[model samples]
Target: MQPLTKLLHFGYQQALSSLFPVIIFLTLAGTKAIQVPGLPRYDLILLVCVMAQIIMVKTGLETKDELKVITLFHIFGLVLELYKVHMGSWAYPDFAYSKIAGVPLYSGFMYASVASYMVQAWRRLDLMIVRWPHAYWTIPLGALIYINFFSHHFVYDIRWVLTGALFVIFLRTMVYFTVDHERFKMPLTLSFFLIGFFIWIAENISTLLDGYRYPNQGDTWELVHIGKISSWFLLVVVSFIIVAQLKRVKGEGFANQPVPHAKDRNM
Candidate 1:
């Protein structure tokens, strides 16, 4: 395949594979719209999500290790979702027997879907990193970012400071991914911004579909505020920090080998 065509194919696969959970949610919603009688919408969504995860694993779309990552995000995100719904960050905004503390059990899959995409992309794209920091630095920052998502309700929001810290730490880091025979390099920070931007777009779509509602959304649909990109960007940071560990980098490289140079794209 030509390089451009390969790039497009890579992107299509990444978007589709990573978004399996979202697809299932939207599908269950459609089923609910058609007045499926078997289960409530939220419960139906939860069931479909679980089935989707199982299917993905069985089909080898997600590996055991990747499944572990998805499980981690589900737990982490569910706890945060419970808190955010309580604090009115956003809401499930629908009736469901599966609701706990006003947040649906299905909600965490939305977050796990992000990790799903990360691990899938990592494996499919043959991803590698340049100038990655040690685990000690990233782990604590990831923890703080996750913590601030909750603590900011009472304490100060250090997200901005943490954003600066991300740049400081990953400033020199670059991610190398393959499309066809060409190897491409992107700044780690830029990749985070791009992913966050797309997630923001997904957020808007999710809200428009009534997957959830924001404060500004109600009687009519409203575009998700661009400012939410900052929030998503930080969450992306946390997600990336967690998934990057799976690569087991031995240096500024991948698979324990040194990264290739820009001019050396024959890989």
Candidate 2:
């Protein structure tokens, strides 16, 4: 394929893979703008997200295994949300019957959307990792990255330390994906950063729609701190590691796929 056509095809696939997340963002904006007489915005968002998930499954857009992975992320995200909200890092200011401890149940979908994107992109792009590190290296790193999110508030902040460790661990890793009939490769760490950056952008959009509010936004809405890219970057690392491990356990052997040659034109 020509370079331009290939790029466009890649973009199309990416957008398709992000369909679920796109729906969530639209729901947030839509609910905020057009409130129901009796329904809370958060509750409405929860309803829409649940309906969207059901549709995705019934329509075969999401596989059963993918649903399982997405559910895991939902749990992880909700736990973090509960802790962060309690710690006053951020809050769900709106009232809803579906809320638990001040967080709307819909909040978990935010994290689930990230996993949804990963699994969809993996299948759509035929993603494979080259030179992936062993589980021992990746699992512990992922655990610490997640732990540091909560622990940093009470104890010493070890985010920078974990970030440095991530670089070293994934230095040799490369993500290979196909666009159109051509194959391309990029550093795995770079992919994590790119995904994180885009999520940061989405975070800004979500906050603007009152999806959730950071303490700074209580009075007025402003751009989320650029430094949040680091947190999102680390979160993306944890998400990627979990997805990779799940894929590995399902018998997609990590670091086993041979790199495709330039002459190969089929996906």
Candidate 3:
């Protein structure tokens, strides 16, 4: 493909992969500004999320296995939300029947959307890993990254430590993705940071729409701290490791898979 054609194809695939998240963002913006008679904003958003999931599956936009992974992300994200809210890391001050421990159920879908993007992009771009660290390295690292999210509240924050470790672990790793007939590659760690940065941008948009509030935003909305990008970066790593490792176990890792055929290429 020519340079311009390749860029267009890549952009189209990215937009397609992000369809679910775009819907969620639109729902957030819409619900915040428009209200129904009795339904809470959070409750309305939750309903839309549920309906969107069903519609995606029914329309074959998401596979059953992909939905299962996204659901796992929801559960994991909700647990993190519960703990973070209790710790005063953030607050959901809005009223809603769906609120549990001050968190609206729809919050989990934010995290699930990340997994959804990963799965969709993986399939659409035919992503593959090169020099992925062994399970022994990745599993423990993923666990520590997740644990540190909660443990940092009680102990010294070792996020920078873990961040450094991420560099060392993935230093040689590359992600190969197809843009068209040609293939392209990026440092896997760079992809992690990029995804995290974009999610941080989305987080700002979500907060601006009253999706949730940080402690600093209690009085008025301001831009989310740039430091939150580090958090999202680590979270992205954990999400990627889970999805990538599962693919490996299912015998779909890059080694066993053939280069995608032309007819099979969606981009």
lDDT of each: 0.81, 0.91, 0.91
lDDT of 1 at 240: 87
lDDT of 3 by residue, 1-267 (tens): 577998999899999999989999999988887899899999999999999999999999999999999999999999999999999999999899999999999999999999999999999988878788889999999999999999998999999999999899989887778887677777889999999999999999999998999999988899999999999999999999999998998866464333444433222
Residues 77-150, model 2: lDDT tens digits: 99999999999999999899999999999999999999999999999988878889988899999999999999
What is the TM-score (0 to 1) of candidate 2?
0.96
Select the stronger candidate by TM-score from 1 and 3.
3
For candidate 3, give the lDDT of residue 191.
95
Please identify model 3 stretches exceeding 4 Å from their true place.
Answer: 256-267
State each model's C-alpha RMSD to the native: 2.8, 2.1, 2.9
Residue range 1-267, candidate 1, lDDT tens digits: 576796698778677666675675576458546755766778878888888899888988788888998999999899989989899988887888999999889888899999998888877777777778888889999999999999999999999999999899988787888765567777789999999998998888788878889887977989999999999999999998877776564232353344654433522
Off by over 4 Å in 2: 261-267
41: Cα error in model 1, Å: 0.7
TM-score of each: 0.90, 0.96, 0.95
RMSD in angstroms, candidate 1? 2.8
What TM-score would you give candidate 1 relative to the actual structure?
0.90
